[model samples]
Structures are given as structure tokens and as C-alpha cells.
Target: MAQKDGSTGSRERVLAAAAAMLAEDATAKLSVRAVAARAGVSTGSLRFHFPNQRALQDAVLARIYGHLFPDEQIHDRSLPARDRLVNCLRQALAPTGTGQQARETWTKAYRTYIASAPTEDVRAAYRAMDQAGRRRIEYWLTVLADEGALPKEDQASRVRFLSAVLDGLSIERALPTDESILRSETETLYTAVDCVLGGA
Candidate 1:
């Protein structure tokens, strides 16, 4: 069932609907058939785009990040190591495709994960997205270590540690008050980043 509006195809509709579903449920009830129904397409059409759970997960992550930083310039690989980390965190805090650069998205994501405890597949999908974020962070961290900006002994652990902190902060993004409060939270995040990277 092709939608009347101008979407690319079943693929685009599926991803769009899936992302919205992920936003609302606070759990990963992201079954193929369910998503298909949400997209108003057949399961076959949905699978034609996603093929499998991991594929769908990857697409969801890609959709979120891609929309957040469509013209990404920090991934040039030639920029300074510190700049990469800054850019990485910048993207992390950016508003999503729907201009939700605030904390509500984090609340929804947390809710989704809480709801996902009963389903290993949904849990794995969440972990996959988290790992994807970690991998991006790791790339910049590795560059920093290579440039001698970060410690070499525990690079892997360092990335994981920082990623965990950042991810947690991301969840608390919507918990701030006024502008001053937001600034305070932002400073806390920067401090955590500094703590993780061992200060620049």
C-alpha cells in the first residue's frame, strides 16, 4: 500500500514510522509486521527494505544520526583530534530529524529500553545503536590516542567509559530548567568529557 504523500517508498515510510514508534513506546515493540502495519505497508514490503532486525536497527540509527548531521564535516579524518571529540559530542546533543534536540527524546528512548527488557531482539537493537554511537566516539578517541592526545594504555576502555557517561547525560537532556540550568548541565557534560579524555 503506497502512501499518497511523497515519500520515497515503503522503505522510507517504514523507517519514518519505525522511528516515531520508537519515540513513543519507550519500548522496542519493533516487530517487522507491526512496523509494516504502522507504515501501512505489507510485511513483505517492509522486509524488502529492512530484510532483518539488525538491518532495521542499523537503518533506524542511520536515520537518526544522518538527519541530525546531514552535512557532517567533522568526519574529515584530517581535523585535529580534540576537534573530532567536540564534533562527536556536538552531534550527540544535536536535535534529531524532527528538531528534538532536547531531553524528551532521551526520555522516550529510556522508556523504550525499559519496555524492551522482555525482548532480547529489541534489547540487542538498542545495544546496537548504543554501540554505533560508541564506535563513532571510539574512532575519534583512537585518533586522539594516535596523536598522543589521549592515553594509549586503555583506549578501548576509555572510549566505553566516556560513551557511557555521554549516553547517560543524553538521557538526562530533557531534565534541565531555564537557560542557566541548561548551561549548567552543558558544563557538567563538558566536565565529564574532560574527565573521560583525561583533559583534552
Candidate 2:
């Protein structure tokens, strides 16, 4: 079991290396040799964990999703319902805690995933991540309702409206903006979230 655990840890390290490489430089083509070197593992070892290059890519995509669109539940019942909702949506928007530079890198990586070049498998991985993001939003909403923080109203409508507002702010942030305006995005997001959740 110890032996298996070591190998498992190594495998995870290789995947993390690849994901970081993908996030650090989005334009660089991810080659087997490159990833192996970046991961500080022999090519044979990399292949031992991942049967093929495509398999490694798939693992990297999964790792990215784990950061970008997590399915894990966040239980912060200590906070007020409004605060919990704010924290939850803030997490959903940027699970990686990525700043502007890192966020741009991730954006580029995603654009490549949906590009015309990759095989269907690679593209499909990305599509699944989209579904996972939606499900995560619903999961948090359900938790809030169950906690009696949010009223047991139309959860679906709340998710949709909140998602739209968040996504819109996300898009707007992509554009060049002054620091004051960018800083306000957080307060604005909380205000919008509070209003939509009927807690304002």
C-alpha cells in the first residue's frame, strides 16, 4: 500500500506540473517530452502513469477543472446566509484564487481546448467541466436553502439569475478597466448577490 501511495503521489505531481505548465504559458504546445521535463520525471515514468500523451492531456484537463469548477461542498454555516452566499459565489467564479495574469493564462488554455485542433475527447473533457460548473452552483444554492438562510423559493431561477450576474461581471473584468472600477466589482458582486437572494 505504501508503494502504491508513492506512485499515486508521483502521478499526481506529474499532472500538477502539466497543469501549471498549461496555466503558465498557454501558447506552448504540450509535448510528452516537454511535460516530462517540466514534471522532472523520466518519459518512461510519465508514460507508466499515463498510458499515452492524450491520456496525460486528459488528466491535465481534469486537474484544471478541479481548480476551475469544483464539485466539493463548502460548509461555512458559521457565517450569515448572505455571507455564505457571497463566499460561495466568489469561490465558484475563481476557485484557483488566480489573479489577473493567471486568469488570463487559464482563459487562453480553455480557448485552446475548444479550438478546432484537438480531438473530440479533449473537447468533450471541456464540455464536461461546463456541466460541472452549473451543478456546483445548484449544489451551493440547495445547501443555503436547507440551512434556512435562503427562502425555499425557486432555486432554479436564483441559480440562473445569479450565474448570469456573475458571468457578466466576469466578462466585464476581461476588458481593460481602472483600478477603482475593478475593486468595486467585488462589492458590486456582493450587492447583486444579496439583492437576488432577497436578503438585501
Candidate 3:
């Protein structure tokens, strides 16, 4: 029983450490060695809990998704479907602050992921994060589709279009802009939402 308890404790610690790293930098590499070092556990121990990087990433993302969307507003039938989806997409863009804070955030991102040729690990980390975002957007679309609120459009194409709009808006947040930009952002989000809902 003691051995089992210790094993569970080690696993939790490793997961907590990995999640912390991700929270600190969304594009952080979750190499076993790095996670083990952060967790104060042996690589063998981390591997015992998570057999591979992909497994570890998936687990971490699941944990994060649970925490982030505990009360998912997308399912609120009281609101118009378009409003709910626009709200969901807005939440996805919430992290990109405006003005100087946004500029600093973008600066850090550029230095970390775009300043030079990224290593394979960096590329993999970025891809994992990007895919997670795509999955989330796709999930939102699927929910609306299931409710008959959205047309039976190609889900992948819709996700791509919405993601591109969000990405552009995020970049705009960091640029020099006027106060009206916030209203413009909302208008843009509405436009994108309208496009996906087939102007319904």
C-alpha cells in the first residue's frame, strides 16, 4: 500500500510540474528530462507515469481543458447560438491583452519561437499547442452543429477560417492601436461568427 501511495504521489508531482511549465510558457517543451528535473523526480519515474512525450502532453492538455472550461458557456441554450459561439471564441482570445502588455507578450513570443531557427523540440512544442487550440475550436463547432444551430458545413474549413481571424486579431492587439480597436475587434469577431454560421 505504501509503494502504491508513493507511486501515485510521484505521478501527481510530475503532472503538476509539467502543467506549471506550460502555464509559464504555452510553447514550453515537455521533454521527459526537463519535466523530471522540474518535478524533482527521476526520468524513470516520469516515464513510469507517462510512457512518452505525446502521452504526457495529452494528459496535461486534458487536465488544463478540465480546469479551463469547468463551466463552459458554449452550452448555454438561453443565449443565441451565435452569441454563445462568439463568446467562446472571445475566451480563446482573452489572453492577448491590449496596448503595452500585449506588445510585451508578443515580444516574448517572437524571441522565444521566431527569433531564429527553432530546434525540433521547439517546433514540436509549438505544433502541440497549436493543435490543441484547433481541437478546442473544432469542439465548439461540433457542439453547435449537434444542436442544429449551425449549418452542416465542413467543420475543418470553418475551424481554419475562425482560427485565422482570431490569430490576426491577437496580432492586432499587440500593435499600436486606438481605443476604438476594441470595438473593431468585437465587430470583426461578429463578422467571422456570421460567416461561419452562414449569416444566420
Candidate 4:
């Protein structure tokens, strides 16, 4: 059913609601009908916005990416490579909230997404997002090379390796209940980086 005024805002509201639901429960068995019911919209309205699960998944990923990485200048040449890398990793891993409730909720949502056994289309969507993230890593690596911290020839491979490490750490430590643990692990990772770069 069209909104009385034909506002697209209603469609956006439904998408946002679906993203929240997906974030909260990974195995929620979602469908246009279910999401429509959850979003307080008619089934026809949900279908009008998203015709299939793949469409819904892509929309959800887009919303999540926007939330996770807002429009911001991510790299600064003025800072040392290590500092810039640390800043990027921290931003990527920063917890969204201070308390256990928020941490658990966000962690659960992230875990669900990571565990997704998506369809071919959903997998392609994930791959595109992964490539974007890897590009960010490569950008940092290029900056590091310009700063003489790493060799320029292997920058792409090096960034992929570093990104994998950071992704592992994000899954492990990003949801810490204690700020001390988060700080300690981050400092430990930075120390490892320092040792590696010290010889360069």
C-alpha cells in the first residue's frame, strides 16, 4: 500500500527496521512478509521495496556499512605509519557502547553476519564489501611505503595480511566488557607492530 502522501520515507523506515532485526537475530528466517509485519507495513509495500532476499541482504549490508564507516577522512599523511595504522585499526574495532548490554547486543549481531552462509548474490555482496575494506588497508600500506616504513612492491599483499590479522582481532577483542582489556590488547598489538617496524 502506498503511503497516503507517497513518501519514500516509509520504505526507508522498513529497510532500517529490517537491518536492526538482522543485526539482532542472524537466523531470524526473514522474508518480505515477516519484515513487513515487523515494520508495520503491508506485504505489498515490502515487496515494492525489495523483491527478494538478495535485495534485502544487499540493502542491509549497505545500511551496516554506512553505520560502521561514516563519511570521514580516514588517513592523514602527517602522522607516522604506525600511528595511522593504529588509528585505523582502533576505529575499526572501537566498541559502540560502554556497557555489557550494548557490547553483547552488537557482538551478537556482528557474529551473526560473519557466520552467514549466504547465497551466491549475498556472497557477492559480501565480497564487494570485503574488497572495499581491503582497499582501505592498501591505502594505509601505500602511505606507510611513502613514509619509508615498508617496501612499495609488496604493499597490496602486506595490506591483505594485515587486514586479516586486524579482522581476527576485531572478532576476538572488540566486545570486551572491561576497557582495560581492550586497551591492553590494543597496546600489545601496537607493541608487536613497533617491534616489526623497528628493524626497518
lDDT of 4 by residue, 1-200 (tens): 55775647667877878877766654444677778888888877777778776466556655665476565233465777677677776665564343465467456756555566666756656665566566555555554655688765655566566667666665455454445766775786687556445646
Q: Write the per-residue lDDT of candidate 3 for residues 159-187, one digit (tens) a residue.
A: 89998998899899988765677799899
Model 3 lDDT, residue 48, Cα: 89
- Stronger candidate by lDDT (1 vs 4): 1
Model 1, 152-183: lDDT tens per residue? 56656777887776665555555544456346
RMSD of 2: 11.8
Order the numbered candidates by TM-score, best leading: 3, 1, 2, 4
Model 3 residue 63 distance off true place after TM-score fit, in angstroms: 10
**Model 3 lDDT on a 0 to 1 scale:** 0.82
Ranking by lDDT: 3, 2, 1, 4
Against the true structure, whose lDDT is highest? 3
Off by over 4 Å in 3: 1-68
| Model with the higher TM-score, candidate 2 or 3 | 3
Clashing residue pairs for model 3: none
As for candidate 1, its clashing pairs are 26-111, 26-112, 27-112, 95-101, 103-174
Sum up the clashes in candidate 4. Answer: 0
Q: What are the models' TM-scores? A: 0.52, 0.50, 0.66, 0.49
